[model samples]
Target: MASAVSENPFGRSITTEDIVDTLGFFDSWEDRYKYIIDLGKELPAMPDELKTEDRLIRGCQSQVWLEPSEQDGYFEFQADSDAFIVKGLLGVILSAYNHKRAGEILDFDIDSYFDELDLMRHLSPTRGNGLRAMVQRIREIAGE
Candidate 1:
């Protein structure tokens, strides 16, 4: 049988650098947010059956589910969220972590990346916490 990992190919081609460049191009946070939502729209839909309780991530202001798998030392991720902004946030996080080797994912300075984006400062505390939760979970999966 084909693995669950294979069933879901990461169709998003945007890279972290692409996000950074795009964010830089936007002068206002509102524009940046729009871009983010656009990015979320690019994420392929995860199968409804895969969005089970086990995949549900806690501590998010929005309902988010992430299912991960490993192949040839790289990680594959499939995620969805009830909120548009949160789904966009997932897209951002995925740009950083998806299809990366565990060491690369671990070595990445996510906080610095956020700082560069000036992202956390604009987010509500709850949303910020939720973003952190998603990052933490990805790290945990990478560390495994």
Candidate 2:
């Protein structure tokens, strides 16, 4: 695994730089979707043990599990979902916030980032709501 430095000037685990780099690699939203799905493939699968009640994310139509761990003073997240789109959304969240301190992740300007990417407006209402739920669950884990 490629390790990112723990302290980032941007105060985000995954910077706008990372997202820009990712976007540059794909030619179209279809290709981007493929890349996003591929990112989901890279997520460490949530353990069956962690799939109990405590890890479940509320407000999601699918069964979503998120397990957070702190290593080397950085928070790392492992997540999974039974639904494909939810899995992809989890990938998006992980790409942005995994491997950061709780404070940094909590401080990240996520709405601005999503607006810059033109993401939420393009999504269906349900998917957008589910995305917000995912972010909320992660933020809650960060204790924000």
Candidate 3:
């Protein structure tokens, strides 16, 4: 999966650098939605076993599943949801922290990232809260 990211320059790898790069490209929420959905398409499928009750994200209006595994020094994630926009939001998040160390993920300025992308203001209240819940869940997993 990492190799796939390396192969496509336009398909930004799940990294902070890529997120910064992506926010620079899209000019509006509509364009950003297209970009985010494209990111979701790039996500590797979540394993069926990892999609169980324990991995479910709470506070989400839609069913969301997220699983994290640490390999070497980084955390690898697998996530999915029944809702399309939520899936896309998960993709946006994975782009920022997937395959990165817990400390790094914790250190990221998520609010700044959202502000730069102009994301939360445009999202519905429920979706915005879901996004916060997702981040909080990941932070708890990181023990940060």
Worst 10 residues of 1 by lDDT: 1-10
lDDT of 3 by residue, 1-144 (tens): 121243222334566557657768877778878777777777788777778898899999998999887777677678998877788889888776676667777877888888877789989999999999999998888874
- Residue runs of model 2 more than 4 Å from their true location after superposition: 1-16, 25-27
Worst ten-residue run, lDDT, model 2?
1-10
Arranged by TM-score, best first? 1, 3, 2
On residues 24-77, what C-alpha lDDT tens digit does candidate 1 reach at each position?
Answer: 999999999999998888898999999899999999989999999887777878
**Per-residue lDDT tens digits of candidate 2, residues 10-119?**
34454455765786787678777776677677666777888988888888878888888877667788899887767877877787678777887888888877776667
Error of 2 at 130 (Å): 1.1
Best by lDDT: 1
For TM-score, the strongest prediction is: 1
The better-scoring model by TM-score among 2 and 3 is 3
Clashes of each: 0, 0, 0
Lowest summed lDDT across 10 adjacent residues in model 3 is found at: 1-10
TM-score of each: 0.90, 0.81, 0.84
TM-score of 1: 0.90
